[model samples]
Target: MIRKANISEIDQILAITKACGERMKEDGIFQWNETYPNAEAFQKDIERGELYVYISEDIVLGCIVISTIMDEEYKSVKWLTPNSNNYYIHRLAVHPKHQGKGIARKMMDFAEELAVQKNFVSVRLDTFSKNIRNQKFYKARGYKQLENIYFPNQSEFPFYCYELPLKK
Candidate 1:
């Protein structure tokens, strides 16, 4: 069950992100850390009504941000669908306890469905360059890898951007 997250659910979402950050650090995936995706960022997502939480029997197991808002940082990258409006996925995470249960894939499926429903042209995301697991995941989903960008606080290594075009 995926639904828009309310401002009241901010703390729960933050907890999930914090736990995810810890797990990523443990796994040596520095995509997120103490500085990124804090409460303020989630608040912005909630305000924009872009944050979607995956819940089951009232338990929030995961969340993903699906929005058309383009980040200024993305301007430097050469995107496949540069001129088209597209859905972007950010801060997508499944609780460690719920990992390997296809939750992330389900959230992505939902994102793609929403994009199609909205008549969007494509889906865009940036994955940690060092996270081979996620790179494989996106590639298997037909997302073409594009230019690399960096999140200075997250890592000095480049983050590869990917796009999945909905149009043939």
Candidate 2:
């Protein structure tokens, strides 16, 4: 089941992200690191009621952030829909142990449904340019690739932005 994250589950959520970061590093993905997706970020997401967790049998398997808040960096991107009002996705991660179970896809489905229900223009997110798997994942779901954005703290490489328009 997917639901809003609670403060008590923060520890479990952090563990999942830490493990994911390690696995990405081992795979030379270099997408997530110790500095990104830290506890503070998740804490804020929970406080704002934007963080959602995927759980099974009372254990948190993955988490995703769905918010209307747009990063300043996104303003420079050439989005397909031209409107800035969209569901912005962030900190999407699945526990390394539970990743192959399609938990991420389910959470994404939830996010897109929420967007459609709320009448949002689209869904927007950024994935590491080097993370080929992630790029394909979004593209397969009909998210159009947009201009690249950089988070210097994360890596020197660019992060590609994607948008899935729900309306014309």
Candidate 3:
């Protein structure tokens, strides 16, 4: 089941992110590390009621943040969809041990459904340029790749922005 994340789940959420980071590093992907997606970020996300977690058998398998707020950096991109009334996706993470079980896909499905219900024009997100798997995943879901954005603290490489238009 997917539901809003509680503050108490922060520890499990952090663990999932940590495991995911370790797994990515093992595969030579430096998308996440000790800095980005830290506890503070998740805490703020929870406080804002934007963070959602995927649970199974009482375990927090994954998490995703869907919000109407976009970062200032997004304003610089020439997006395919209009800026207003859009949903921005962030911190999409699935535990390595529970991966390949379609948890991430389900979370995305939930997010998109919520977007449609909220009359959002599109769903916007970013993927690490070096993470080919993630890039392909979003592209396959019809997310159009736009220009790149940078998170200097996370990696030297730029992150690619993507948008999936919900309205014609």
Which structure among the candidates has the greatest TM-score? Answer: 3
**Ranked by lDDT, top first:** 3, 2, 1
Cα lDDT of model 2 by residue, 1-168, tens digit? 999999999999999999999999888989888888888999999999999999999999999999999899898888888666699999999999998889999999999999988889999999998898899999999999989999999999999999999963
Q: What C-alpha lDDT do the candidate models reach, one value each?
A: 0.90, 0.93, 0.94
Preferred candidate (TM-score higher): 2 or 3: 3
Superpose all Cα atoms of candidate 3 onto the true structure and report the RMSD in Å to 1 decimal: 0.8
Per-model TM-score on C-alpha atoms: 0.96, 0.97, 0.98
As for candidate 2, its clashing pairs are none
lDDT of 3 by residue, 1-26 (tens): 99999999999999999999999999
Tell me, what's the RMSD of every candidate?
A: 1.1, 1.0, 0.8
Give the lowest summed-lDDT range of ten residues in model 3.
159-168
**How much does candidate 3 score in TM-score?**
0.98
Count clashing residue pairs per candidate.
0, 0, 0
Best by lDDT: 3
Q: Which residue segments of model 3 deviate by more than 4 Å?
A: none
Worst 10 residues of 1 by lDDT: 76-85
Off by over 4 Å in 1: none
